[model samples]
Target chain A: MWELIRANKRNSIVLMVIMASVLLVLGFVIGMVFFGQEGGFFGLMIATTIWLVLTLISFSSGDQILLSASRAQPITHEVHPQLFNVVEEMKIAAGLPAMPKIYIINDPAPNAFATGRNPQNASVAVTAGLLARLNRDELQGVIAHEISHIVHRDILFVTLAGIMLGSIVLLSQVFLRGMFYSSMGGSRRRYSSGGKGGGQAQIVMLVIAIIAAILAPIMAQLLYFALSRRREYLADAGAARLTRYPEGLASALEKIAGDPSPQLATVNKVTAPMYIVNPFKKAKQIKLSNLTSTHPPISERIKILRNLSQGASFNEYSDAYANVTHKKTIVPVAALSTKEDVPLRQASAEAGSEERLDKQMRQVGDIIRRVNQFIFLTCACGLKLKIPPNYKSNKINCPRCNKSLDIPRK
Target chain B: MGTSILIVFLILVGIPLLLILFVIGIYNALVRLRNQVDNAWSQIDVQLKRRHDLIPNLVETAKGYMKHERGTFEAITQARSQAMGAKTVSEAAKAEGALGEALSKFMLVVENYPDLKANQNFLAVQEELTGTENKIAFARQSYNDQVLFFNNKIQMFPSNIIAGMFGFTKRDFFEIEVAAEREVPKVSFS
Candidate 1:
């Protein structure tokens, strides 16, 4: 595991350096286009400053931003004891230093994500529908996958890389839009006002700058997607190893992918990659776009997970991945070298009857209502009333018995 | 003469210093692994304590509807006490396995009492008991994993020499001794 983290850290640094250089070069060329040769250094300085500021913001409160963006409410252990216990179990299994704070999104989509700068400060957020749908073993599988992301330090890497990609995209968009609106003839005339030789060089620089602005974001995105896809595989392997049950994750992935619910309401392109399953309904249907996706195909991920037959070790996951994908191993060699024979454990006994499903659904609804400050009133006629916090009336008559009841005060 | 003296000094002091530093590095790593093993063991202890605390509530809840099942109650109580009194990892492992077996038997007998199954208190206790059991199992799994890593480090090459010098020893795994644990519970449908 340490080897995996170290390798991830190294690769992240290399990718960041490549991204930083791309940002700087793009800035330099754009600067040259706008202010002739002298503006190159000025543009480089601006790019560096922008990168630093964005990095600062993400490192300090990126998790908070993401949690709020998803409309996730902080949940105590009482809101869902089983969920807390499962997260605790995964924390032990992964040997994380502290428990990641738990949150519940109001959305009905069955998806989850982990976010923090590091494991110690991490938080795991799951949608309300996930809690209502998955059984204990399946829930553990999902939490274990998110915990694995925290353990592997993937959150930090993805945050840094995502910021870089955002900066590059933002810069290119601004430059392209500015070029579109402004006249190209003005820049050409402005360059010719300098000197003939310098004017020709400036024109060449402007063309190169336009081309760089066009291609830089694409190249950066491809790099980011390549690394992110590999990290997903590694996190999957880590999840299997941590939970010691590959089938749980496999089934959970299938359920989440096969869910017919609408896409998560708050999910945008920036936060889409953070989810366990791609939140975009369109990504799964298009095979060609899968290459540029931050995550590997759901079917491929599920297949790799199901192929882990022998045990839940890095080596086993690597073998299963190779068998399923017919590709090179994603797990680091050092991680695979640890010959810990982690035998898979039996699934926790759970009854998945229809009655149990209804009960689970009710429990999840109650939990969400509780978080939303809903007041519960039980009538003498056996009717349960759920009053929203914003209810204007102090008393309400039961629909069943027409008996007025005062709302319980906190 | 001066150059030769410098060469002699380099060979004598530089090499031994490097060796000591190397030994120190290995020793520190071994110590870290040892501490991790100790930490993992404490995690198991915590889950075991939780299991012990929940068993009485479980028995108390079941005692109401299971009037004729005195033997199952006594078996669970006895196993719980034994597990609590256990002094070492292997001892705790054996005691906990016995407790687990007794609890499973009690649950099987619970099937005969529909009233007890329907009681909300019993159901809550059962949920907590099962969650604690899963936690204990996961904790034990990780404990054993840490023990394996520590034991391997103390027994494997290069580090073994440092381990010997520092008196590092192998730790026992929390193994399940009850043969019944490995057996699948029979589900009979009449």
Candidate 2:
């Protein structure tokens, strides 16, 4: 997994550089055409600044923003103990240094994603629907898949790609709209039109500028979709290798893909690719050949995961994928060489009971209460003291016994 | 003349700076690898502590129902104390192996007693102890992996030179030595 993660970092760097260079080139072209010769340098400067700022902000605090925006409350073992245990198990499987923080959204939509700059700073968020819907092995499978994403450094690339792609689309819209306003004025054209040879060149540049502006964001987006689809396949393979139970993830993918509610209240296009299946539940028949969407078809991903009964290795994934899609080269050759094959395990398909799930949900509620600054203390007389996180006291007296309990002063 | 000056500038200034940067990067990475090995060892420590804490409760829960199983209970206590005293990884492995053998024998004896098996408290403790055992095995595997990676870094070519310079020595792996658990749980990458 470490070797695979190193390889992933290399690929992410190469892709990010490619995306940023494209953005810079577009900026240069647009600037030069609009403001004569000097705007090219200014354009590069502006684009570099935007790229730097976006990457810096996202690198530092993007995970928090993503979690908070989705109304995901941070949870601990005391509250959502089973989820913590599962995360711990996956951490051991993925060989992560520590368990990534866990969060739960109150919404009933069944979606989950991993986010952060790296494994240490990473977080995994799941909706209430996800907890209520999937069984234990299925839940483990989803977690392993998310852990794979963190181990592979996919989160950083996704965040950086999103920033660059967003900047390009925004800039393109600004330029296209500027062209509209300038054309309506029609006064600036006469000044440039005074020089005969220069006038013709300017008109050609304007036409090319308009064409480039219209095409650049679309081109960037297509590249992004291309990048994430391959990473998703790799993450699935990584998840299988970690859990040694491909069918667990395979069946979970089936449940998620088959789920009726596809829309998440907090999801947008930028964070959609981070999800196991595309959150747009409406796109039922997303195909590998389709160039429009960020994720490959859910049915195909499930088929490939189910095919891993043969073995868990990059080569086996390629073979299984080939069996289903009749196409090879799903995993890159460099990654294939570093991949280790693990022996297959027979399916142990025990599902969790509803009683257990109810307990787990109640635990999640207690965790949310704790996260919201609610203080809980136990007394010798079998009574509980409930106080807020910001209760502002160094000590609290137990209501039943009236004995003082020490509170860590912040 | 301008190209010749640039070449001289690169050789005289650029080379030393690059060399210094390379040394710093390799040194930092080696330190990071060593720290990861330490952290993985601590995870194993945490799991072992959990197992140790659960053993007393397990014995206490089963004591009343199994009067004839007094010998097995004593053996478990002896093994537990031995494991607690075991200081090194290899020593701990041997101690743990003996403990596992005793515990498995104890479990086999447990099958004859219907009252102990039916006790709700005994069942919960047994479930928890089994979970702890699984966690302990995983933690050991994780530790060995980290140690192996750390060992590789210190022995490999270019970085080994820096490792030697920085005194980063190779660490021992956590191997499960008992035949019972070892037979089923071997690390078979082949």
Candidate 3:
């Protein structure tokens, strides 16, 4: 993931250089055609200055702006210790230098994002809905996915795209205003004679300028979205590598896709790509049209993830998505129940008048027991103990101290 | 003529745009690194608090078993105090080490009393404390990771240039200096 992030950073720099050169040439051509040589030169200068100023402001304050926009409140461990632990574990796994701060948004939608120009100054924010909804493994998967974004510096790409889009929109507006004023001035300057030819030429210029104004922003937005979609795929691949559990992320995506919430209040078009799942819920009413939207269809994303989980190659995953039907699978909630009897076994059996509740409790207890096997214990006798499956016997003696013990019956 | 126009356009507009994007990228990266460090520290804080919360219950559980082990109990309390009192990263690491050692010694004393080990309250507190310890270790690892990323960025090229220009300096990783610091002192029943 780190290597990919480094490569992406280099790629972004090269891309920026190419993009700037293209824009510069475009600006020059437009300037020369519309204005005299000196006017064209000054116009390009003004555009560059505007771009530079906007870029700097966004770079330095972009994370803060995004955080504030998302209404992400800074969280202490007291607020959510489980989240803190998962992030901590991931940070170590990634060999990061410092742990990124965690934040929680009050919204009920299950979504998460990482922000900061780099890992050190980074933060991971998740909706309160996510914390309440996801189990440990699912939460780990989601957080890992967000951390991948931070590692990959995808946020930088998104920010730059946004700036470019903004610049394009601004330039289009400038062109429109310039055409309007220029035509009005030309009208005032012309007295009689060849008014028809001059008026026709002015009208052609106005139409061209209006068309450019309307179309340029849309084109820029499409370009931005295309770049974002690629970054999302790259981030997903990076996350899968970092977690070494494609199923973890795949399951997380399944859950996110199944959720039926509207777009998060904090999200706008610009910050939407930063999320682990696209926070913006597409309108169910709209027909499938690739005409306007940014994100690749969520159903398709989940299918790709499912393919990845099956150990399919990335090429295979992509190919599978290309031909897969976009039908939603109705996953019965009962089928999702794995180890549901575990936690219940720990509950004292005395209060069980409700048979169904008792059955559910037993399921929970069973799962807890299975989970307990993973929990390491250091016995008082200075012996490391691994609880065995059949150790549920009446009197289990400690191997080192020969002390008799009663293993708690859960 | 068009080539000249392109060259002039690049010189006048292209360089500034590239510089702007680079600046934005570097600045955002630094901010992200800084936030990660803060997050890592908070994780440690949460675990420490959990550990601290478990201490009173642990001491109480041991109190009935080790009536004569007043010195060990006092040491554990003192260590916990020192750990809690620690403000800086190095200080917290040292204090936490002391607390772990003291807690282990206290646990060893409990080994002598079969009744204490059997007591559900003691077992619960012990289990909870162990869980907290695991959390702290994870948090420490995370903190170190973020610090590494932040420090590397400040030291690496291009971004480093921007980092230096912006007065962003490398941060020290929160780490246990000695193996002894990480070891929970062994309590022997023999």
Off by over 4 Å in 2: A1-3, A186-197, A284-289, A338-341, A344-410, B1-39, B55-79, B87-91, B94-134, B144-190
TM-score of chain B of 3: 0.86
Candidate with maximal TM-score: 1
Top lDDT model:
1
Expressed as tens digits, the lDDT of each residue in B91-151 for candidate 3 is: 9888888887787667667768878866756765765665566567656655665786788
Model 1, range B1-190, lDDT digits (tens) per residue? 9999999999999999999999989998998998999998899889989999998899888887988999999999999999999997678789999999998788878889988887767877887887788888888888888999899889999999889887998888777898888777667898
Instruction: Say which prediction, candidate 2 or candidate 3, comes out ahead on lDDT.
Output: 2
Best by DockQ: 1
- Report the C-alpha lDDT of model 3 over A1-410, residue by residue, as the tens digit: 24445566776776566556545544654564465344557657766877798789888987888888898878665334557777876775455667898877767688898887777788888886676556555676787777767777777777776776677677777777776786677744542343667556555654654665676677666666666666666555545544545556676777777877665787776677678776767674267465455666666666665555343323333434444644332221232231111100011111223663444334333333333342234567877555766555656677889887666545
CAPRI-style class, candidate 1: medium
* Global fold similarity of model 3 (TM-score): 0.54
Off by over 4 Å in 3: A1-3, A18-37, A174-208, A288-292, A308-410, B1-190
How far out, in Å, is residue A238 in model 3?
2.6
For each of the candidates, the C-alpha root-mean-square deviation to the true structure, in angstroms, is 2.4, 7.0, 17.5
Model 1 chain A weakest 10-residue run by lDDT: A183-192
Better of 1 and 2 by DockQ: 1
Those runs of model 1 whose alpha carbons end farther than 4 Å from true positions after fitting are: A184-189, A283-287, A392-397, A402-406, B1-12, B65-68, B112-121, B185-190
Interface RMSD (Å) of candidate 3 = 4.9
Q: Proportion of native contacts in model 1? A: 0.59
